[model samples]
Target: MILLEWILFLFLFLGLVFLMGKYMSSVYLGEDTFFTVIGKPLENLIYKTSGINPAEEMNWKQYGLNLVIFNLLGCLVVFLLQVIQGYLPLNPIHAANVHWDLALNTAISFMTNTNWQSYSGESTLTWLVQMLGLTVQNFLSAATGMAAMVAMLRGFTRKETDKIGNFWVDLTRGTVYILIPLSILFSVFLISQGVLQTFHPYQHFYTMENQSQVLPTGPVASQVAIKQLGSNGGGFFGVNSAHPFENPNGLTNIFEMAAILFLPLALVLSFGYMVGNIKQGLAFLISMLVILLLGTGIVWWAEMLGNPLLIKYGIAHGVSMEGVESRFGVLISSFWGLLTTATSNGSVNSMHDSLMPITTLVYMFNMGVGEVVFGGVGVGIIGMLYYALLVMFLAGLMIGRTPEFLGKKLGPREMYLSVIALLVPPILMLIFAAIALMIPSTVGCMNNSSAHGLSELLYAFLSGAGNNGSAFAGLNTNTLYYNFSLGITMFISRFVTILPALAIGGSLAEKKSIPESSATFPTTGILFIAMLIAVVIIMGSLTFFPVFTMGPLLDHLFMIHGKVY
Candidate 1:
């Protein structure tokens, strides 16, 4: 029955991917979509009011500049809101201003679409800040990533053209047509599933045991909808999806898991359509799906194996349910853990700190691989394309020919940028993590000692650098040092890769596309899929394996010997 549930979920998810992918392609390609009826008018209204000329396109440099400026402005607004949130309206519970460091970390996190929350939402922010600051950035940040992706795709499909597409146009179309509509529908679904949406303050009541309890409530349903849809996974509550109000039931759990991957996966199909080759997109989609499934399976197996120390003492059953929600159990929790990390949608339904060591390793590896296993909405496909370029270059060298993908020849400039984009995250993750471990103040942040402590610190920077927001839950990341260090990591990891990708897109746009020939390697086949998977693994393993041996791998061996850390 459990296996059947997994099968059904995958089937429904793929169906949605196909339908949504086709629709998104039409929307971005400037074709008249069904959304055009309403979306077109709204899009025009936004442009007219904002003085944006939708028809005026931009080169990669111009597009990137506008994107960065817009995000920085949004970040500023969010930071200011947090600093003075106590002065803002709708503070039913009188939430005070956020500390500058946490506020800065958060602003950058959401602006980059990372959404790594150093502070809990319900207690730290008012409803106004939630809606005005975080929720608004949720939409814009997601649109920013989608716009970057569409611009990069334009690089591949167009030749000898400096202009890709207008950033303002793509940004408007994505938010107005894609994100807003989907969020509305998903919000309704969530509200129906018992997720809370209200302006009421915290409710105090006595439980059956006569103990007072506070029930936190506010605009949770609306935020939860986009947090999943936009791959912005900051929780309205500290416990995130684990809280009953955020994810109320098994059905909600299943749907939210699917929602996390929906856009990222659909965009893969959209890539195929945009580039005029469905098979090519499928190859990328399949490679991602294969990795996601394999990782989830490993997590399931590890969690099911349970804790050896507990089993030896005969205190409980073999299955590890220490921090898992009984409502979802091991099967769903493990799947959610892997899926959330894989897609850079970092909402969690269970405590990751309590998972088996090997399961945590799988979660870290998901982010360590740069979250390209169905990554974030627009960025996932973009990251995968970098790997695609690298594979093409490698195949070219083997065959003694110039490597080309989708007819564009891979040159030194493109390859250099691709290497930088691919290497920056892992390198930063390691460097910052090493720096943190050496500082006694930073070392004090760990909730556990030995190998598990190493995993905690490693996971924090990994989450930041990969733009993944989930944490090990055992680290005290709210401190000044962590907030500032992780903030820097998030900023560098996001733009360092993004700027290079844009430069590569610009370079590709200026070149003439080579004609396909008998010697040209086919990207749409089992061979290509296998090679892509191999390259992803090799790249990830080469960078992350040494750390894995010290952290999760060592912890797992210790667990086997009945040593708990």
Candidate 2:
């Protein structure tokens, strides 16, 4: 039955991918699609107001500068909003101004499309900040990522041109045409499923036990729509989608999960449409799907196996659903865990900290692989492309041939940038995690000691360094040290990865395509797919194997000995 459900969901998702791919191609091409007609005026108005020339194309340096400057400005605005949110209007709950360090962290977090929250949303931010500051970045940051991706794709599609595309134009078109319309529809659907959408103050209610409760509410549905669709996964409420108000029912749960993956998968097809080859896109999709399905299956099985400690205590088939929300059950929770981390959507339906040890490893591995399992919308596929280049490079060496991808020769500049992009996240994750471990002050953040505690620290750095915002929820990362350190990690991870990707795109764009020959490697075949999978796994294993032994692996061994973290 579970297998059948997976099959059904896969079919539905593939159909959505094809439909959305066509729509997104139209969006990037500035064609008269359904959304374009509605959004064109607004898009133009934005360009005019911002003093951006839609016709202006930029070289890689110009494009990179614009993107960085725009994001820096966004970060500054978001930081100020949090610092002065108390003085701002629409403060029905009168949430106090955020502390400086946390505010700075939050600003960078949202701006980078990392959304790595260091504080609870309801207690820390007012509606105005949520909508104007955080929510606004949700759209822009996601748009920025998608825009970067479009620019990168232009490298493959356009020949003899150093210009990738207009960053501002791509950003505008992505938000106006691709993200907003879909978000609006999803928000309405969520409202119908009992997710809240309002401007009223927190409602006072009595629980069944007659205790006073302040139910936090706001424009949650609006924010949530883009959070999932844009792959910006910060929760409006503290508990995120796990909160009943955010994800109240099974239908809503499914919708949000589908939404998390929707664009990333579709963008793969968009790659095909832009390159004029559907099979090439599907090859990427297949690689991602294989990784995703494997991770999900392993997690689900581990959760269902029942913890050995519980089994010894006479709970038959002792499933470890301790941290899972009762409303969603074990399977959905595990599925969601895999989906959220796999897509770089860190929104959670269950607490990741309480998962079985093997499950935790899968979550870590997903992000460790750069979240290329249908990663974040534009960035996810682009990240995969880097790995594809790496695979090509390695394959080319083994066969004693010059490497090539998408008809562009893989020269040293391209290969070097791709290697740097591929390695930076893992290197940063390890270095930062080690520093955190070696420091006595950071030691107090752990909610558990020994292996599980180590896992929490590793996961935090991994999540931040990968631009994946999910947390183990077992670490008190609200300290000044973490706020700054992880914020830096997020900043470096987001940009360092992006800069190289854009650079490669620019490099590839300048080159002319050569015709395919018998010596040329085929990217769409099973051979390529196998190589792609091998490259991702080998890279992931090689970088993190030592760390894994001390964290999740030890935790699993401890659990089998009837010792639990």
Candidate 3:
């Protein structure tokens, strides 16, 4: 029955992804005008407010430099907030100022849209710091990513224009016009659903239920919005939204889930609008949906099955699962698990390390596959484009044709860049894990398969460093080694990918859009979308096969029998 549940959930999740992908293309393809919805209105508003021209473009160098400056400035600000949290007025617990190293790690985590938190939420950060520092970065970082993606899209859409859009303008508009409004509206809805919004520390009282507890409090509604909207996954509390004070109830859970995905889905529409090609954006959207649903199902099914080893040992005697929370339930927790990682939000409700081997692999695979499916709003869209470009490049080679995406010819320079973007993370993950395992600092589950234990540790860093914040959870990750290694991985996971993406965006911007010809491949249609899916899976399978065998694959083999495969 448990196995049956696992199978059913997997199918359902995949079905959802496929349907969403197809639906985005069919229903919203170049349908709404951003100028009407977001652009022209924003233009007038900008002029009236600051007398700045929204229509004017800036050179890529200025744009890139602006991005660097904004990020560096943000990093310093978040770092300072951590140092001063103890003195801040809004701290509920009057939490001590965190150690400098931990503070720095947290600061960079969000600034890069990497949100790889190193501390527990309730115990460590004051509400003031959470709102002003970490939460603030969630919005800024997300906006930054969105701005970068928009810039990239502009590159492909424009002709003979050295400008890839202005960074300051894009940054301002992204927050003022798009992210802030959406965040506020969503934040309000969350507050109404029993998630807290307060200036005071947690109010404590004697409970009839008779257990010692620290009621967590925060300006969660505000932070929750961008965590999802920005796809930055830095949770208000340590366990993420799982802490009752942070998420609270089913409606809030649903709201958070929607928040995480809404922008990503809408951004698909925005992409098509930017490029003036509804079909192209639809194609990308569909591909993202397909991948997201697949991961969701794996998690749902794995949780539903309980743990096979536990079942075999009779450790879990109940009909339903034990490790999972009854409040969230398997269906929702499973959904959140998959959504969080696939989109690069790392918070988990039910512990991922507790899941079955195959289940664990599914989660790891989401990050390993480039994390582009509805990825961190801006990051996901841009990240997937790189793979899309790569697959197109390979297909062109196979057919003895010059490959091009959206009319820009993807020659050797572009393909090489795409290849590096795809390959770098996995190489980094393997090397990082090898070092951790070699040192005694990192350890895994004692009884479960050794391969499984290695996977548990590997998944922790992979998900963290890869910018998908979901973890296997079994591995203890707060050590200096994890603190630093995962921190560095998150940095590279971002800049490495962004550098190539920006460079490609610049290159694509230079080329004129070529009209469809006899040789032209239609990127918007089902055939091309199917090809893109194939490309992602193939790229993932080919690049990570060796390390995968040592981890999830071997774990599965050992699960069937105790001895190493």
Give per-model TM-scores.
0.98, 0.97, 0.87
Better of 2 and 3 by lDDT: 2
Write down the lDDT of every candidate, Cα atoms only. Answer: 0.90, 0.89, 0.73
Among residues 3 or more apart in sequence or in different chains, the pairs in candidate 3 whose N, CA or C atoms overlap within 3 Å are 21-286, 92-201, 109-115, 121-238, 155-509, 346-469, 346-470, 353-472
* 10 residues in a row with least lDDT, candidate 2: 29-38
Error of 2 at 258 (Å): 0.3
Q: Positional deviation of 153 in candidate 2, in angstroms?
A: 1.2
Better of 2 and 3 by TM-score: 2
Candidate 2 local lDDT, 249-303, one digit each (tens): 9889988999998998899989888888889999999998899888888887788
If both were scored by TM-score, which would come out higher, candidate 1 or candidate 3? 1
> What tens-digit string does per-residue lDDT give for candidate 1 at 277-324?
999999998899898878877887888788878876674667888888
| Superposition error at 162 for model 1 (Å) | 0.8
